[model samples]
Target: QSSNVPKLGTCITCHGRDGIGTSPVFPNLAGQKSLYMVQQLELFRSGARKSEMMNVVAKSLTDAEIEALAAYYEGLDPGK
Candidate 1:
């Protein structure tokens, strides 16, 4: 299951290696709600969410991959 998603680096390019987000413009995905994350990614893939970057990335990913990513990011500590 974990093997399906690309390495963390692939996610890090935009979301940051730690999933903390590099800027305020990018939502802090670390320790985010998994349900919300999955929903948003599904939306992006389905065009319900409108972002060129997200759409492109989500479109190619399978459900398992999405779930894995959601789980991975949601597990982050994200210390405040």
Candidate 2:
């Protein structure tokens, strides 16, 4: 994983270290399916997804970073 929670630039702004979003507009990333996150992130990187914020963030991420982030988020306990 090239990226860690602390190393995350924009993600940590909305989705915190625990993957829980700080605002209602930001969807919770905790315990989400890794594959789903990977797919969505890939789409966001490729401009297939239409989130202005996500696109900018994903654009700077590598494949390994994306997988790492997805795994990290998926492992978080939403019930926490």
Candidate 3:
């Protein structure tokens, strides 16, 4: 992965270190299906999933970045 990707940093703020969200309002991304994570990220990027913060955050990600993020989160163990 490249050091230039920003979504990883942006994600940690709400989704926590590895996509285990800080609270109920923020859904846990860790252990989620990779394709599902990609879909939601795309939706947020395209404004289909209406979230002011996510819309802007997702918009900043490229397709490669999205895929990388999905894979990163999907690989996490939710139980941890």
Ranked by lDDT, the better of candidates 1 and 2 is 2
lDDT of 1 at 64: 85
Tens-place lDDT per residue, model 2, 13-77, is: 89987788999999999899999999999999999999988998899999998998888889889
Question: Every model's Cα RMSD, please?
Answer: 2.4, 2.4, 2.1
TM-score of every model? 0.86, 0.88, 0.88
- Residue 25 of model 2 has an lDDT of 94
Model 3 Cα displacement at 70 (Å)?
0.3
Q: Between prediction 1 and prediction 3, which has the larger lDDT?
A: 3
Using alpha carbons, what is the TM-score of model 2? Answer: 0.88
Across 1-80, the per-residue lDDT of candidate 1 in tens digits comes to 33455655566777886778787778788899989999999999999999988888889889888888999889887885
lDDT of 3 at 69: 87
Q: What lDDT is obtained when candidate 3 is compared to the true structure? A: 0.86
* lDDT of all predictions: 0.82, 0.85, 0.86
